[model samples]
Target: MAKDFHPPYPWQTGLWQQLRHDRQQLGHALLLYGRAGIGKYAFARYLSQALLCKQPHSGHPCGECASCHWFNEESHPDFRLLSPEQAAESDDESAPSKKTKKKTQISVSQIRDLNEFLSLSSHRNDGARIVLIQPAEALNAASANALLKMLEEPAPDVIFILVANQLQRLLPTIISRCQKVSMPAPSESQALAWLSEQGVQNAQQQLAYASGSPIQVVNEQAQLTTLADIWQQLALGSKLQPHLAASMLIAHSAETGIIALQKWLCDLLTMRLTKQVHYHIGQSGALQGLSDKVNLSQLMQLQKKVDELRKLALHPLNHELQLEALLVEYTRVFVNK
Candidate 1:
């Protein structure tokens, strides 16, 4: 569903221009892929809305038109958004289930349901129909196969925009049917300038912490206090209590807490070997302290384990216990010399 349709970030200007330049020869499906948190989804939404708008200006939507109003209100007949959560919500709304478990994939049924929409003509004369599937890697095997059929015989007047952060996860057949657009990530200076414009303090720290993603910096700012507390507990190293630290860490989410530890461990591993600190330059002293005391072999193993856990973070597992076990292992990696 469409949220507040803020224009794409400033760094996306070049890519935006490129998309507009090729508007006439656009394919039935466009695959927009790039780094996470770099505003790929937002760009796709903007482009889709622009294409559906009755009065598009220079490849962007004319914000005042009735079509644009319908788009902003998430009621545009010609536009459909297919994401895991959105698909589940629609099912729940119609089926009236008792708080069904959240879905994680673009299900086969969701893709099959598109047939009904594809059979209908556009609501307006000469208006282009659009379907935007965000994080396209969320398509499971069956769903991907169903979608592959659509791509093979694309319905007229419909444009499918598949946005993905992890392109490697997509099927080769699926990727081949679409026109691929490689989204750009802003440089450090560009990202910092944008963060400055947003009046975000400590932009440099947030930028590095977010791996140069400005959107990530903005999102993480909301949880800075929690992150700082987690970092402090991590800085305790061998002294950190696994149960206590896990309690604080799980206050956010298992994924958040694991990512924090993974970052810290990454820096610890790197600093131990390369004398380089990446994500937590602000906590270089803490990282360096842990790096000196941590067992190199054990640290490497734990890093791998933590990385693996991140992939399974969305599973309905006991996250607090998992985190506690990880933290206990984290403490073991450090020992009194």
Candidate 2:
């Protein structure tokens, strides 16, 4: 049986019931919009499985069925998942000698290829077809336009489920065509409870760092140690070694390192201005000590640079060097002891 063949998250129970009960009222295109790392993609997947299940029980997928098996195996004939990574895979089959940059946009060609799939009838005569576009914001202008045409004249019994974290990035026409479903974010209590159920340690602290997203906390478990080390180095303020810190910071990826820096900077600002830390709840003492020494204007300037670096994290640039420069700047932002 498939691992993902389970029910929706506990917090999503109500919404799931409502959606399942009103399945007939759902539009051909469903826009599931919400904050990232809040299980929106998981919800979409569960819904898709349920829709394609041959033996759906009480509006849920029966894990024992052939359709469920196919879906779990990612070989369902009636289902297609359109994502930037998927588009990249289809476009680049040749093995690259060097480390190639990952693709970030769904190309127009990926959208155009769907025409043949849309024209074909479902594998099961009476079953429905599903096209799931995750992080729909990844659809570039050309691809978005191509998708719009399909949405305007959708195929018979075909459901287009678009999942998005940033809803504002999507075109207005696309938003208007679909039935928007506002996926709920779990409350702090709900999130903590879920984390506890999963046997995650330091749930409250992790939850705060993840911006209350339970899913993100779970996903970032392995990086917790690295993040803690980064925080300790950051707390060193003016005495921090830029070169050594830069190597450790970008150990995972340039983006991850940048985000960690951004969050640390955010907490520093919060601590400096309001005497309260948001993300780094457990680092209050360290933040307070550093915040007092931090030059506000200099910190803000470094924050802007970090933001810019994060935006260009995917580009083929010397991230380690850039990060090292930023850490050096970070050191300069604090007064000498």
Candidate 3:
């Protein structure tokens, strides 16, 4: 086991116990589905490690044995993890470039490569072999069909754990073959406490921005400062300069900047209709003022445009110019009261 390997979060304790208690009755495949950033992947990894642990205590891996060492070093003969190539390289800042298109799907070749691993017997005496596929929605048509064949005829002593953020994206046949587990999200208090322990500032505001997902709040800390700068420009409303704001908006990536704009527009709309804020709780005053000066019909039309632009954010288009045009329209959405 790795030093980072530990028991599940407080919210996941019951699910952990249920699965551990029924370990013998567990099926060959498990589909762990939930919203993004709720620790589903981490839970799957923990379960995989424990299942292959040579000396597990109370269904937890003892971080000392040879098997545990092998697992920690990512050299366990019986374990295999699958993910999109781009996702695997996401941590490297230089991974994304104009010369190379990012691969988003799990190709059929990846699934075919698993056949050899599935055919091999476990290196340990009767120990289980684990194959973990994270964000299982990444499996496209050909790969999903290839994976479905294996699920249809599962190998003995092999456990397949599929982690998905969007359950509907998976093939229905692939879903039907696995036992589905709905991972739990922490409560407001639980999330706040966890964020506090992790030394996060403004836990309440960040939590709201993350849609109550604590993991996202932590993962997105780096961007929060940039978000704040963007919000300041957006607060100018009708006075905002499109060309200047467009540069700041796409500072990270066009996708990230568009998402920020989308959230701000959503909050502004919500404030206009209900006098309530969703994503930008801290900026409710600004949203309320902007909403008062904005035309409802124009705002709605602009929102639709933004949504369409967001769908095409990954396309190799002139994103800065598109953002600038959107911002120009954004200023026009407001009228003198």
Candidate 4:
């Protein structure tokens, strides 16, 4: 319905094209699984538009049509979307806080709200009623079970598109009810080329740091500009300096920030393995020194450690304690260096 519907990325176009065709014949429900920020949300939206479009071109929706305009304005009564609340109100905003509030998970209430919204007949009376639920795993057991019931007996001409970052977290019954579509990460070279084309001066460096995610690299470049100083200390294996740096980094950005730092470590290790001297996104003189200090085995171990920590981040853990433990463990791994 939106006139400004951005097309899927070049890599994602084929998948969307396929989904468009499926919608033409009227698919009931779909589960779209992909890593975050890979345009899963956008793709779901594109599909929703195609289904509701009164004047579609082949399988694609005509953006210029009236239905498309309503969709774009987010006024289409048939269209619904649900996502986790971004930030909760802090108790003490006036005082300096050490930690921010976590993004709350989607609960049974949201799903219940959706059930009520969809139970009624379509507002438009004829087009498909579309619902897009992102990071659907944020649902608690009660919420998930509620969704399961709806999927089992979906209304006629209704579509449910569930997007998830971690498919494994979903119940098997939930996954089995809908068609599964995998959104693979782009190839390393393809991601790097996209970054470079976007005028990233150090495309090689950034791509290596990002680990095949252009958005992650670009986002880190903008958000973690201070990481350079912290990384420099870590590269030199300055024990005291790294602890301080880690503290500062953790203090500034929580789980997501640490995830980016883990990406940096992975990139350095990747370069170490391949003996590639350049970074795709940005310059980092410390990479070479760090590579020399840590062997391939050590780097691989650290990479695994990072992954373990990232998985824990998805849960309702104590952020402060988790970060402190993570930093301490990170230091202990390369203490010999």
Give the per-residue Cα lDDT of candidate 2 at 234.
Answer: 91
What's the TM-score of every candidate structure? Answer: 0.90, 0.94, 0.89, 0.72
- lDDT, residue 120, candidate 3: 91
How much is the lDDT of residue 237 in candidate 1?
94
lDDT of 2: 0.90
User: Which digits, one per residue and each the tens of the lDDT, describe model 3 over residues 198-263?
Assistant: 778888988999899877787778887577778889999999989989999888888889999999
Candidate topping lDDT: 2
The order by descending lDDT is 2, 3, 1, 4
Instruction: Quote model 3's TM-score.
Output: 0.89
Q: How do the residues 1-337 of candidate 2 rate in per-residue lDDT, one tens digit apiece? A: 1233234988789999999889999899999998888899989999999999988999999988999999999999999999988866765666553236778988899899999999999999999999999889999999999999999999999999999999899999999999999998888888887888877888898888888888887777888657889888999999999999999898988888899999999999999999998889999999999998999999999999999999898787899999999999999998865
Show the colliding residue pairs in model 2: none
Q: Which candidate is the best by TM-score?
A: 2
**Whole-model lDDT for model 1 versus the true structure?**
0.87
What candidate 2 gets wrong by more than 4 Å, as runs, is 1-7, 94-99
Per-model CA lDDT versus the true structure: 0.87, 0.90, 0.88, 0.69
* 199 Cα displacement, candidate 3 (Å): 1.0
What total of clashing residue pairs does each candidate reach?
Answer: 0, 0, 1, 17
Candidate 3 C-alpha RMSD relative to the actual structure: 3.5
Point out where model 3 deviates above 4 Å: 1-7, 86-99
